[model samples]
Target: MAGVESAFPTKRLSVPTADPQPSFLVFGAPRIEEAEIAEVEACLRSGWLGTGPRVAQFEQDFARWRGVTPSRVAAVNSCTAALHVSMVAANLEPESEVITTPLTFCATVNAILHAGLTPVLADVDPHTQNIDPAAIEAAITPRTRAILPVHFAGRPCDMDRIMAIANKHGLVVVEDCAHAIESEFRGRPVGTFGDFGCFSFYVTKNVVTGEGGMILGRHEESIARARILALHGMSKDAWHRFSDQGYRHYQVVECGFKYNMMDLQAAIGIHQLARVEANWQRRRQLWERYDQDLAGLPLQLPPPPEPDTRHGYHLYTVMIDETRCGIGRDGFLEAMNTARIGTGVHYLSVPEHPYYQQRFGWRPDQWPHAVRLGRQTVSLPLSPAMSHADLARVIEAVHGLIPA
Candidate 1:
């Protein structure tokens, strides 16, 4: 397919680079400072490292940051864990259908399937590459019980329309906020709009805990249920059982997975959460630089946020036009690698994966927008750890490699 140029294109800039960069620029290195190091050290010193006070504090602090009550948050091992527990809390019957976007990481769909629900893929919007609310509404059927919308590349989906459709259909809404810790829709955080918001703190996500996640909800009962489910369905978590008061016995209430986040991870999260906004500011500046520097290239930069929305700027993704750029997306990635600049693909559309294709018999052409984006999209390195020189190297490498 031909590359689609931006409507407001600028003159291309020429940057000369005789040699590849001396050192490889990794795509998503966690920005670990003295504070993160000290916090983790403190956890090691404390010895109450397994799902203890630090995890409790992180959850409380996260809830306060999101303007939700502390009881509304449940800390887990990964966003996948959060999503799975949220689905279980939703109490949907086995084989119930979940309408979701195809333009997300497989974990989003995998959670649905793991929860014994059918994943019904909805095509994405051509511009935002987000689940189109119209497509979601169209895909809903009598068997549909939930809607899982991913905030792709940290851009918030059209929640107003999605919420309206979900409300009209009486469907559960589980928001996949893996890339959207800093994203907001009309002043409200992305996760707060849905019935349950699942957030990631993976190495590459906006916030880094190495590997952790949180689930946010408004209802106390559901949040309590998620808390129990996250820790193996125990009547009492270890933190409560072995507290200074006494050793309390715990009973298994139901069969559940061990998805609790450790205090060691939460120690990192506590500090990461503290500086997330500042880190987001840095990423926003870098995103703008990429926008200005790569304006006229044979690429489609990520869409800007709509009015009144705040983008997380988690991943600076661009779609390559092979014909115009004189290279396919994979070729572009290799070229970037040769220049010692690391890059990534946010995802291939869920149905395009071999597992999904063979299991569901999904065709790539069924969701044309998702298929196209999946084929063309490439994520440039965008992280708080990136220095100004690192940004310049990436910009220069991109300009030098893509044909004018």
Candidate 2:
């Protein structure tokens, strides 16, 4: 459970010598402003509220922004739905296995279960909190049908290694990109790497629409299948049906569910997407300040991307090894809370969930790396809403709590 060291520790951080203090704090607030609200109101007034022009435009815009064709993107109501649709498109057989990280949100694994795939817990590399790519080959077996890799906390996984293993094993790749909106890996955006990339626009995400998601597929057919799975399995073009040239005939070609994105949400999303770039810049500056300010602090700062990638700053997390910090993560959080500062845990290892434990019978020691992460990690507030004073207060609190 060793943590990675940062390069500029001398100038970036200092070990705390006193108790900390923070008057206020925030985490991942929506970057949208009044214009976003106006967009939604326009949609409301338009009266075509359900999966209509606005939703279609959102899907089209999202695809264009991602540099993918429109047919390769399917807008849905939740990342969970996007994942569910992706898993179905994967055509996984019942009881087939999918290897995924334990240090992700439950939705990632639950999507596998909902698709009737057996979820296999893979321990993370403590350094990255990403599924250890090396362990994946060992986890693969005849029953393995897919590998779902989550870009944890907006940090892209080593896609090259993961993809290589998937190709060798003939397993499908479904990336859980719920935390990563514009995250990149090796100079390419994250959602573009895998067979299917599922994104969440939950209130807390980098590009959110209150509640919605998008699935980016690698192939037109695969993307089309996802659309079918999302919209009650209607195979015909849902759009052309109502036009004069459109035919009345349609077919329920597949067994599917309704996971369509509503016009209202899409309206909100159009504006959120525009502000993401600017919000990301401020996020980078704030993140750098946190690292620099806490450089010599007792615990290690989270490592930056390895020169070839960009983190979306979804969560400004730092790892605390009690042995180094002289306090465990829980105690440190308590101290921060007492100082009127707020904090959050991104997740514990996914396998620790009751359903997984009962079904997989996995143990904490089995994924030692993920277990260690759950024990030692804490999420510092990082959002565009935070002011300079708020940032300073967080630094002050952390510096105060570290034992000299």
For all candidates in order, the CA lDDT equals 0.92, 0.86
| Tens-digit lDDT track of model 2 for 235-336 | 754454654565767799998998988988999998888788888898889999998888877776788877789887788888888888888889988888
* Per-candidate TM-score against the hidden true structure: 0.94, 0.89
Judged by lDDT, which candidate is best?
A: 1
What's model 2's overall lDDT? 0.86
Candidate 1 lDDT over 28-80, as tens digits, reads 88899999899899989987889989999999999999999999999999999
Local lDDT at 404 for model 2: 39
TM match of model 2 to true structure: 0.89
| Candidate 1 runs further than 4 Å off | 1-21
